[model samples]
Target chain A: MSTNKIDPTKWVDKYSDYLFNYTIVRVNDREIANDLISETFLAGLKSMKNFKGEASERTWLISILKRKIIDHYRRINSKKGQAEVRIKYSDDSNEGDWLEEQAPDRLDMTAEDIMENEELGLAIIRCMENLPEKQAKIFKMKTIEGFDTEAICNEFNITPSNLWVIIHRARTTLAQCLEKNWF
Target chain B: MSKFKSIFVDCSKAGNCCDKAQYNEASLPEKVKMLVHLALCKPCRKYSNKNTKLTKLIKDCDLKTCTEEEKQAWKEKIKQEIALKDRG
Candidate 1:
């Protein structure tokens, strides 16, 4: 709301926790996440004039933060100069180290059942990360974006039939991952 | 599973998990499909819905804002910047 354009100070006061939690949720390393947060705010200040307020300020800022995190990983991968980075955006996923195992009975659960099942919820997030690239894209498009068929096909460059295949594959993979890992 | 001669999809496109229509048109054919694999298997239906609900809850919720210490630090930083701006 300041006349001077991007208010780094305002963004810091407003969304720092959101940004912190968002980065920490994706990047496990505290120092790396903090560095990314700082850089996101720094970059956001530089680009604030260009933001144009099309999306919510939060979305704009988070988009910058996410891009920065992706860049961080890219830098590390390039440093190694490997074929590709092993980082599948799955690095922060919690493994089985946290909780005592019970069973895969969540397969028989409803929304209420699983939310109450916090362990199961964490496991499901991990399972989502393990999905194949195409399948993960489909699931994210459908489940997260709430996109209908035509839009998704256009975004992913596949026919509706192919879209169906991808979603099916993703659902199957998710089910299996949940059963084996967290269920 | 029995493969059909391709329903409306002629040239044998790769089979999908389930078509979008199956999600809605609960016609006999839709019932013949798996979204309702639940009425036949309520447990699995329960599981699928559970996942959907969890995702919705997370996506549609409030995200917490900056903390007290963070706010204080931000104010102090802003004050320092303003002082420098005045001096300039």
Candidate 2:
């Protein structure tokens, strides 16, 4: 028997940001990422009946998104006719020196760095899932969105002290959760 | 004893100040008290270090959230698709 169940209505609130962050980095365009995510959500809905309760909803959606991204590249590649490879040797005098210079700087994000950051980002969001609904919302507003204290207080109808308490709890929980895997 | 009491803050209060300081929201006096507490409190200092590291990790991760309008648009699309499926 499957251990997980699908709930389409809550997918946006629960996974949109995770999906957006995952897609934006892969596609490198906001509009294209958004469109792809929209398509992923629709595709997920179509396949809802096929979902076994084995994997969690987020994991299942991500699998569909991976295929969507692959398909996107496949479409673009087909439109470009044949594959082409280009190499540059602007300075013959320098020989191999220019090629070495053209290599990525040490400070640039390597494929490994990108992969680690992606995993870290997703892990943080996953830790957030363990928080109470209200605490997670407030923490995201305060920490991620960078809303002002008074503004958040007014929106949530809570005092600054209450907000701080919630933020403290959220931070403590997140730090503990991440410590094992990330910290 | 009384003077020390004025500067002394419990661990929870120290934690609150540390959390506020992470966001640059702690007042100077609050920060001073928190620091004084950390100077004498071993666990609070450890907690403060971990808290600071957590803040840096969060900042370094560079996570982004979608706007409310974007989320609403997605929700609307999902709702529409579900409704259409029902009719079809």
Candidate 3:
């Protein structure tokens, strides 16, 4: 095992941008992403002795950062049981069907329209940020990471029903938000 | 027709079906229900279409990253904290 004590000061110059980008995309918040990068570096420093040189230092730091993000989501979920309550109350009206006025209009954007429109991307990210923290994390994991239902259920310790409900609510809220902001 | 009964689903159920279909978690019956509902209900159809588009947009969007100045400042702050801890 090649044991080179990784320099803490060098990490910022080397991996900060990469880590920052990785985290900002996942969290969709700059301040939180910066905090996560700091935490990841500290955590990596504490565990530096465990580094076996099996992976590059950058990869090692990234692994720590990913776990930090997951922990961040778990912490958000545990702090409030309101997510379930929100889901329950949201669909109670009209048995979850959209009202005539609330129903989304056709987006009418061609693939070219969508790809060329930078505003649309920003609108989506903004809407995602508006999502309840746990919902945003779950939506990112499901859609961006392509995590399967069982994996998400195992990670969140939620039932399949709960997962579906959270995702359903997240999508509904995103759709409504996008309709208001983008359309 | 028997085929119609197999596919028939209500609007409320169709909402759940749409979500399930997005995740590839829908049962055969649920998939059939969503298809039937989408074929018949314009609003639900629109909702499904938009939902798919939103997911695609989010998945594909080139999200902004933190700037170099921001990263450098965070790094310096973290280094300061580590030094303080070492001294104390």
For A5-114, candidate 1 gives per-residue lDDT tens digits of: 34556666456655765766567666677678777766765565698756767778889988999999889878785565342332356454333333255567577753
Q: Per-candidate DockQ versus the true complex?
A: 0.15, 0.79, 0.19
Across A1-183, the per-residue lDDT of candidate 3 in tens digits comes to: 674557777787556645765776578788888888888988887787789887778778989998999999999879786665332324566565546556676588566764555556556655666688688777767876678888999999999889878988898888888876554
Better of 2 and 3 by lDDT: 2
Q: Which portions of model 1 miss their true places by more than 4 Å?
A: A1-121, A180-183, B1-28, B32-88
Q: Itemize residue pairs with steric clashes in candidate 1.
A: A103-A183, A104-A183, A111-B50
Superposed Cα RMSD, model 1: 18.0
Off by over 4 Å in 3: A1-119, A181-183, B1-6, B62-88
**What TM-score should be assigned to candidate 3?**
0.48
| Candidate 1 lDDT by residue in tens digits, B10-58 | 2112123233333441245543544435445555565556445444443
lDDT of 3 at B51: 79
Report the CAPRI category for model 3.
incorrect
Which predicted model would earn the best TM-score?
Answer: 2
Q: How accurate is candidate 2 locally (lDDT)?
A: 0.92
Q: Positional deviation of B76 in candidate 3, in angstroms?
A: 12
CAPRI verdict (incorrect, acceptable, medium, high) for model 1: incorrect
